[model samples]
Target: MPVPIPGNPLGYTLVYAIDSPKGPVLVDAGWNHPDAWAALRGGLLSLGIEVGSVSGVVVTHFHPDHAGLAGQVREASGAWIAMHEADAALVKLMRGFAEEEHHDFQADMLRRAGAPAEEVGAAAGQRPWVPAQPDRELRDGDLVDVPGRTLRAIHTPGHTPGHLCLHLADADRLFTGDHVLPGITPHVGIYPYDRDDVDPLGDFLTSLERVADLGGDRLLTALPAHEWIFPDVAARAAEIRHHHEEKLSTLAGLLADRAEPPTIWETAAMMTWNKPWEDLPPMLRGMAAGEAAAHLRALEARGHIRRVQGVDPVRFQALDS
Candidate 1:
């Protein structure tokens, strides 16, 4: 029977305990909150699955919401915790960043994006920096053996460098973490810690195509972190792709407007939906502006745009001229 662990917007973490040749396997350890734990316990009790009955815990990623209480659960259930190896370093970095560096980075990035000093500091202060690490490492295509089920790991990096999704071959079900949301577009901004090869947006597009190739008829159930569960995966992927194309077009148009090009800040302001500088959220404003700059850089690399460095800010213009 499929048990829905309660407390999340998805209503419950869909956990399946099968009578496999081994024992039982737990998919994801949902958010680490008392309420989340209570709901999970209730769901398990309803299914007559005792804590000790759980044999293993497999996580999609190392995000707090997905792998939050994995260690605790592992200790309690005596189940081995498994995650992708690519994210192991990231998990460690997040721990340190949360305690000592995230606020400073956020403040610096916002300031660089032209946010007011005070607002930058305030927004940074409001950011939370709780971090935890994953236990065992999982790799792409690694098969996790459940009682009667087998989940194959698919490396879906975009939202995060180590993000993952699980494919259940027999059931044709996908357990997507934050990689694919139903309604909202996932943020694919460049992270300071990311390498030059980590083009989140590009990787995201590829990941979507991969998902599409996995047979369009499979059911996708995602833990939104907020909002309801959406069964339509392909539609959501298409929507995200369309949103990016629109953003890219808007950015290109902004660059074309200037004969001499403009600074990153100027281009960002133009690319944005003309939101008043003061009313926009500091983080969002920074993200939008930063992403616009990134898009311009990518365009320049492709010979589609030309870049000019000036005293005030760097600028870009379409290359046709």
Candidate 2:
């Protein structure tokens, strides 16, 4: 089912409905906008299901676009919502934090990522959100209650700390929730909203290996959160893994420059972007920096680069430097 997100790059998110003994179990709830909500309801109705009849919801993560309607659905259908514990903790933290405090936290993060003062001041107001908390906490290897279907949760912690990919044993299908998408690589950047992330890119690479292993020869098609579905998830996994490996190598070369060891900002600017880095909007630029930082952290963790302190903006260099 297609549920639209306002001003989203992708036109809409695909919400998969599984027919179960109790009722239809939904994969993810769409955006919170009125039109988006309407689209979701209409889509469900078209499938001969009512909004109030959804039995369960397995949220892949706590991203606003994915979990926006979760609360509304639960209220309407009394459907039990389940998500990864890590993302659930984040949602709860957001719920507890005051608006001003949350804004300040986001502004501080922008500043840390080398955002200019003006953008930092306007960061929180750009798009504010508070996703509903999950009623159930999912962990790796946990099976979602799909009655006859054996849907196991794979905790993939790169897209988000609690990102999940649901494996359908009976159908040999993998419902990859922004963990793997067709044609493009999923962002493994740090969420600058709050808290420090450690080795996110590393975690992402590991998760790719795990998914590839699971899908080895028996895998069927991959149903991603966006775009079209495709076969050969393992081949796609290898492509993504190689992309990161090449990025690491490229960053290492840049860091190894004798005269100009780069800061995270410099590295991001110098790295090839889908579009010119300078042309991207402030928020996207900050996201780019966070992605660069994730790579830097991954390199540091694996002893490929050394971080230099005492500098105003901080800098990194090849470990041999």
Candidate 3:
């Protein structure tokens, strides 16, 4: 079911309901907005399923678009909520944080990424919604709590540290949340910007490879959380991986040609995007810089580049430089 997310560019989240003798288990709940809740209830009603009869909610990740309505669903039906252990931990941490603390941390992170004063301010203003706590914490290979179903979780850990891709053992179908979208690449960035060797891009690529090698069957259909569902999860995974490889190559060429090391912000400005970097808004610019930092960290992990020593705002250059 496509549940509307008001004011979001992606339009909606594709929420899946798996049937069981107990009740239907929701793979993802839409955004927490009233419209989204109404859509979900109505959509299930059309299928002869009541919102109050839902058995459980197995969230793919902690993102608002996916897990936002899980709490409400549980409230309506007395259903349990489940999510990967890492994401559940994140939820606990976030729920404990004060708004001012979160704002300050984000601002500091952007500053470390070498963002301009304005961009830092704008990006720091953006706050995340507190997610619902999960009753059941899942790990990779664990089966979801859907009676008479074999929906197993696979820890993908890229877009988020605890991102999960579920596989239906009975039907051979995969519910690839944001980990494998058909139309757009998911954002993967290192958070807690001061940590060394935190390579989110590297994790993303490895996760992609794992998904691609799942069964090697070309006809396996993948039901992603957004956009049109596509056949052959392996093919889509390979395409996304190739796109990142090309981006890594581009970043390498850029660093080789530059006379001095570039900060993450400058490196991001130099990379290609949908529009010119100058046209991007401050929040988007911050995101771009974080993405650039992930790519730079991946390169450093492979010994192709290194961080410049003793820099306030961190900078990276080719290893030979």
Candidate 4:
């Protein structure tokens, strides 16, 4: 069922309802607005499932667009919610990140990325990193108790540390949340922490391969959160992986050709974007910098680049150059 996301161009999120012996199980709940709530209720009512008939909820990740109304649903239905433990912790961290220290941390992060004063201010308020408490914290390969369905949680941690994709091998389908989308490549970045420490891009690439391997014979259908259903889960994963690979190569080329070494912020500006670098909003630009830092760290790990640390904003160059 497509539940509307008020004020979003993406229109709505697909909240799949699976028939179980107990009651209906919803894969996701759209935005937690009155309009979105009505949409979900109406959809469920039409399906002969009451708003309170939902027995359980499985969030693919902790993003608000996907899990926004989850709390509301459980409140109404007494439904148990489950998510990977890493994401549960991330949600807590995100919700607590609205304090003065967190704001200062973000500003410092942007400064380290070489962002200007105005951009730093615009990017500082990344509030509402929200989630509800999960009744059960899942691990990789754990079998979810979605009555009558053999749904196994596959920890695909790149999109958001504890992001999960449910593999229903019995039905030959995969419920890929934001981990794998048909029309968009998931964003992976290092931020609010040491870029030298986290390698989100690397983790994302590896997770893609793992999910692709799960596809086995490529006969499975992919049911992504945002987009419509599609077939050939393996091919789609390969396409997304290659998309990131191309980005890695492009960044390596930029590092190789520069007259002077580039800071994370400078390299992000130099890299390609669907929109011109300067034209992107301040928040998105900050996100771009974080992503660039992730790629640089990944390349450093791969021995394709070397870090020139101790610079205010960290700098790097091609190792072979």
Q: How many backbone clashes does candidate 3 have?
A: 0
Give lDDT per model, in order. Answer: 0.64, 0.85, 0.89, 0.84
Top candidate by TM-score: 3
Report the number of clashing residue pairs per model. Answer: 4, 0, 0, 0
In model 2, state the lDDT of residue 220: 56
TM-score ranking, best first: 3, 2, 4, 1
Preferred candidate (TM-score higher): 1 or 3: 3
What value does the lDDT take at residue 236 in candidate 1?
75
The numbered model that scores best in lDDT is 3
CA displacement after TM-score superposition, residue 287 of candidate 4 (Å): 2.6
Candidate ordering by lDDT (highest first): 3, 2, 4, 1
What's the residue-level lDDT of 212 in candidate 1?
Answer: 56
* Candidate 2: residue pairs that collide: none
Per-candidate TM-score against the hidden true structure = 0.76, 0.94, 0.96, 0.93
State the lDDT of candidate 1 residue by residue for 185-283, as single tens digits: 766666541123446667777888777566456555443333455766667777777887788777777667676666555666776544676576665
Which residue pairs show backbone clashes in model 3? none
In model 1, the runs with Cα more than 4 Å from the true position are: 1-23, 98-103, 123-130, 193-197, 216-232, 258-321
